[model samples]
Target: MKAASYDAYAPDNSRLRVGDVPDPRVGPGQVLVEVRAAGVNPVDWKVMAGGLDPIVEAVFPVIPGWDVAGVVAAVGVDTPEFEPGDEVISYARMPIIRHGTFAELVAVPAEFLARRPVALDWAAAGGLPLTGLTALRLLNRLEVTAGDVLLVYGAAGGVGSIAVQLGRERGARVIGTASPRNHDFVRGLGAEPVAYGEGQADRVRDLAPGGVTAVADCVGGQLDTTLAVLAFGGRHASIADPSVTEHGGSSVWTRPDGAALTELAALADQGVLTVEVSRTFPLEEVAAAFDASRTGHTRGKIILTP
Candidate 1:
């Protein structure tokens, strides 16, 4: 299998190396996927760089992606929801516990797999699970609804972009923080864009004269930077650094929820949700991808086309 993996905690040693390995044997309740694409998340690089020291004990040098899309190569008998050749996307729980979708094949429990929208190919579909679930959970946790004013930090990036669209779908008055280059893109998603950095709080306040009712931080450094703009008692959720919570609004961390992924898949298929791919790389170029992630600036999610 052409897999991207490295020695434990040696992110720099990680490379796109080709080695022939025995194929996986499917167990009951599992489905085998001829992996097509894998979503790249910051956590993938963190796993390599040893930056997540607090949770290092629980982490592994495993293949680093959680979101995946592929065709079902096989299915267990007890799972009647799918069959051979079913195109699907999933946040693989078991493989994440061992290997991951950064290989030519991966096996996930049947329940985690959802049929991919015929409208989306592997790259777009693979990008959906992790960020999609994070966006969905954060918006739901903040209880954003119609007429509520919400401010999204990093609104032009992966999770932020999706949250902005979801917030609009839920009827929130959406304001987003992004670079000048992405102002139009975020606006296209229905968010009023506020430039991030000096005077950012002022810009947010200017956007919401009444006050920002809720905040979601997909960007790490923008929270303390936006403190003064949040309405008193406004909720906050973050998928990045929790230091943003110190600014007095709440913070959030993401977890993989199969059910939530299902909901996101449904929304995507219904044309109510979409995933943006800023760039795509083959499995061998993972080091360069991690370097890109370290820069902290990209238009959308980076994808690994396996």
Candidate 2:
């Protein structure tokens, strides 16, 4: 099998390369997926750069990716939930970084695999798992509900865009912050668009005079801004910053849950949720894909087709 791998932690990605590797082993309660597509996220490069080393230890010749959409090639012992030929999507992040989805095949635990939404194509499904799970977890952590006004920072990006839509589906009035060029794009996701920097809190206040009932910070470095516009006793969560907990907000980290992914998939099938894939690269072009994600300007998800 061919995979993108790095033998050492190199922030500049100098050691990252695509080459032939042995096929992944299907352990008990796991399934080997014939990789169709994979999602390129910030964490992919971050892991390669050793940014997550304090938490997730890396082994040499590590394959680096977490999001995948693929077909089950073989099922391991006791894994009765799925069989060969089943289409699935998974946030396949493991406790250690030895194997990942940026390869021709990946072994995913059955507990992490969910049926891919039929409404989404390969690239979209590949991109949906991690970002979708993050947005869902953040909204759940904030306890967003009907009649509440929810404000989302970085609303045009992957997690934020999905968060905006999910907020609207939950009957919350969502106001999303993005650049001027993406205002309409955010609006299309059912959020009232506000420009991100400078006086963003004021703009949010104008939209919801009582202040926002909940805040979801997908982008970091905005805790003060989030506090300024939050209604009294309101809840907030951040995926980017841990310091949010000091301000009475929760720092959310997405976990792999097949059940939650199943619900999200149903929402997509019902037309209540959609994934926007900004660009896609072939597996061999993983480096270019990482470069694009590093730009931090893409309006939606970037995908790697295997």
Candidate 3:
């Protein structure tokens, strides 16, 4: 199996290489997924750049992607939730300490594997897990509903894109923030698009009129703007900041839940939700995929096709 990995935190690329490796072997409470595709998340670069530990402790020489989607090539002992050849998608644990889906195989704790919707292809299913889980958690925090006015920051980005659709599915009058280029795209996802940047707060204010009952800030370094766009004391959550009006530390981040992943998969199967992956790169280009994730303004998810 070909795999790409980095050891120690330094700005050198020599250690990041694509090469053959023994297939992943499952242990009790774990399952081996024959990798088809993996999602390149911001956390991937954060781990490589020595920045991901704050969420969860990091392990060295790490296989660093957080999203996985593939077939269950082998099931761990005593695991009854899945079987061989099961099509699955999952948000691997934060910090994602073990080998990930960047190779031809990954060993995952069964708790992380969620059934992939049969209607979605491997790439589309792979594009989901992490972003969908994040979106589900954020929207849950926002308490979004049809009667509410929902505001989504970074609407064209991965999690934001899913939030737009999911928030709409929850019946909220969705107002999504995006650049002029993504306005039509955001609108097509069933949300009103508010151009982001400069006077983005004013744009949200105009779109939502009186106020926004809930807001999901997917953008970092823009908390002030996000807060300003929210209705007074209205529900607001951010996957990046994790800090609120009075809280501190990283305790506020949304905790991953397999149940939530299941709900998201149901949504995908039902056509009530969707996620877009902008590009797919192979394991050989792991470094470049991280570069793309770090670029900060992509329209959808970036995937690793192993």
TM-score of each: 0.91, 0.99, 0.93
lDDT of 1 by residue, 1-306 (tens): 667765566556443343444566678888889989898888776766666655534334356667899999998668787889889888774523446788888878887777887667789998888788788888998999997898888888888999998999899989998899998988888999998888888777776876888888887776665567778778777777677556655567666566777777788778888788888988878767777866778877888888
lDDT of 1 at 15: 39
Candidate 1, run of 10 with poorest lDDT: 53-62
Between prediction 2 and prediction 3, which has the larger lDDT? Answer: 2
Pairs in clash, predicted candidate 1 = 238-252
Candidate number that wins on TM-score, 2 or 3: 2
User: What's the ranking of the predictions by lDDT, best on top?
Assistant: 2, 3, 1
Q: Write the per-residue lDDT of candidate 3 for residues 1-306, one digit (tens) a residue.
A: 788767776554555767776777789988888889898888666666666556556566666676888989998899999999889888876445657668888888888878998777888888888788788878876667779998888999998999999988888898888889999899899989888778888877877767888878788666777667666667877777756645321213545567888888998889887778789988888888877877897889888998
Predicted candidate 2 versus true structure: per-residue lDDT over 180-211, tens digit per residue: 99999999999999998889888888888888
lDDT (CA) for every model shown?
0.78, 0.94, 0.79
In order, how many clashes per candidate? Answer: 1, 0, 1
Off by over 4 Å in 3: 11-14, 94-96, 247-254
